[model samples]
Target: MENISFNMVFTLSGLKESKVNRYIYFVFVLIVYLLIILFNVTVIVTIILERALHEPMYIFLCNLCFNGLYGTAGFYPKFLSDLVYGIHLISYNGCLLQIFVIYSYGVCEYSTLMIMAYDRFVAICKPLEYHMKMASKTIGRLILFSWSFAFLTVFGGIVLTSRLRLCGSHIDKSYCDNWSVVKLSCLPTTVNNVYGFFVILSAVVQGLFVVYSYMRLINACRKSKENKKKFMQTCVPHLLSLINFTLAILFDTMFSRYESRDFPQSLRNFLQLEFLIIPPLLNPIMYGLKLAKIRKVVFRHHRQIEDSLHTKKR
Candidate 1:
């Protein structure tokens, strides 16, 4: 067998067909990335600066936005540079780092959402005990668990991938993914596959936990109009964000594992990038619009700014 290349750089083939429109694509993506940053940051700052919005639910929302920003930073900068320079190559270490940031972002997202679900479950199902159950210490621990669990889980996969002797350096997708890297290995990847499936199973279990929490919430809300109102006010935004993320992840997973070359290049690219593009953009928007307190705070801040500017102009 030929010696595996440790220093090989991977070529991202997703941009091959878009060379003609790379400039246009770059501008569009840049605008989207900027908007994502702006939207998420707006809410995050609002939560921090406004003490009223510093409850467990809002804290989790802030963390969610932070995770969105963290995840996108891993992809957008490198992607924009690739578009401008017409280079799609990433070094081996860079590839693994990207895989770690992006996938850990994803896992952290699910973990955060799961916590949000539990928060809602407590707030609605056990309103009297909600304070004790989701206190500052509890919320802090949950946040820590979310980040640590995601980092460790994805870290294990990255470590396994780093140990592999790679046979090829070309990645058909726009970004570095754990599965894609494992597929490039020259030898059997049984361990990686087994661990990968375990990760998937863990994520599925998280999803189910969120689902079960919501189910209990629905049952609890059925008895009281006030509970139903709270559910509509707070839980609806979480549900929308959850649905959006689920679909994006589902598309990327299906495409990465079972994609066909016969699909249109643009569609394929969209599938590959939907999670990065949609969730980060949509999560903040949904929270800002649907959550009453956030919406009111954001608009009030905008009005205050406008009034201050008008006074200066006058």
Candidate 2:
């Protein structure tokens, strides 16, 4: 009989094995995560409750909320534990799951933003047919396909990634991640690395196409200064989303090596913000502020909910 040894990869290195800083960072992330989750949840709930918000944009907003949920699902629990208890130990299985969740949600988010971009593009670029083009059935199918594509793309990476054998368990981030886990593999990581790179490139390219399409549509519709301002307003969420995703890619790529002892944990923490902090907070605020219709409907919905609850209590 032959014996096989399984080694722990992606273990913490240079980490003080102390609970102090890890717990502090964890608390910070926990507060941020809760805030983000609460905000996104409120947006989703408001949109669902208000018939006035039952439109293509709000539908896409719901999808974005779920994307945030899924993203936080991957990182929050571990992050919280690391914050309060300083427990960074994760089973190899757990690490893989984290990788899958983080990337899958990220891909889904990018796709959802693209769908929203198209919605805006149609609204501005082809206003006459916007309703017909963004019909409920059509929007439903688009959301379905966006999630499916995200699943398929991240699934490829997951399959490739599963092939690596962990030689040690020293991962070099405040959270579990794909590149950090993969960096610990003793086996040949060539295939997984290439697959990951492909995923990153795809996200970047698709995200830009979304941004460009929306901008072009906006420019085409800008016959009057007022119309131009409105068009730009409509594009704000998409622009912020695109920028966040782009910076994420750049930071992830730059720090992919994980061998750079020079890389500050603060920088790593900031990179984490792109995924955890920005989209959830910014999406709802941008939509509510810039899209007058959404703001009005959301406010109306909130009041209605309050009234209904008050009546029930009475």
Candidate 3:
């Protein structure tokens, strides 16, 4: 008999096999995160070790590196552990902490990206006052605000989830998602669910709007000839991040709905690709590969530093 309860996970219409697919996902995700970790670390280290990359762009890139690091911290370890150990044994406190960290880090990453978009807008569009607008002081404050806001948003979710009395535990996902965890509460979860919906709307929806507006502004000022390349370079990473967030939220919401369980295991497994892995995997590539300036800085600085070291040896 299906283990059922009032606090049961109300999935959309699909019931993924969870075992075989989970391991397959683990291998793929592990590789992806490893690459991302390597890339982000390289970028961070290159920026720090090289004087040539001490500009505004690289500074923000460093922030992004840290943000991506925390985002990975939020999700990956738990996910890999679940694959090696088992998902059926996540402690209640562990689940809550996962939700807290994942949401916090995710929010901070997105918010940091918004700050970066603004930084780019100022640099590319308003080169005249770029320094005045994005001075070191200003950048520091912006980061502080971003981190504080991220904590508040994520902590609010934690407080809300903490109030609920959990009576069932059958999460199909690799990690504990806020909505998934709340769906298992024995007590009335109406408040937590409503709060969660608002959190998604506020963070995801608002973040998307900000990104969209910035891109529009970027295109408005860009010349027709250069627009295509600039647009692609600027938008690709944001678009990938947006798509990942959208899919994760969508499938997660679907996973919370009652009809989801009957949908079929294979179909649900396909959706897991976007939710569990794609966001982290695409982040470093999208951010690193798309920006010509960053690549230039990285390569130039690497060569210069090597030459300086050689000269010192002599």
**For candidate 2, which ten residues in a row score worst on lDDT?**
1-10
Minimal lDDT window, size 10, model 3: 6-15
Task: By TM-score, rank the candidates, best first.
Answer: 1, 2, 3
Q: Residue 167 lDDT in model 2?
A: 60
lDDT (Cα atoms) of all candidates against the true structure: 0.91, 0.73, 0.68
> In model 1, what lDDT does residue 294 have?
95
How well does each candidate superpose onto the true structure, as a TM-score?
Answer: 0.97, 0.86, 0.77
Off by more than 4 A, model 3: 1-27, 208-212, 215-219, 222-236, 257-259, 262-270, 273-276, 300-314
- Alpha-carbon error at 210 in model 3, in Å? 2.0
Question: Model 2: runs farther than 4 Å from truth?
Answer: 1-10, 13-26, 301-314
Lowest summed-lDDT stretch of 10 residues in model 1?
Answer: 1-10
The positional error of residue 161 in candidate 2, measured at the CA in angstroms, is 1.5
Q: Write the number of the candidate with greater lDDT, choosing between 1 and 2.
A: 1
Model 2 agreement with the true structure over 1-314: per-residue lDDT tens digits: 22121334345433353566666666666788888887778788877877787989888988888788888788777767655655567776677778778878878888888888888878777889989999989998999988898889877876766676666666666566677766666778888867877876877787787868866876786676765775667777667876776677567657656445575766665665466677776776776677777777777767988999999999
Query: In terms of TM-score, how similar is model 2 to the real structure?
Result: 0.86
**Model 3 Cα shift for residue 32 (angstroms):** 2.6
lDDT of model number 1: 0.91
Candidate 1 C-alpha error for residue 228, in Å: 1.2
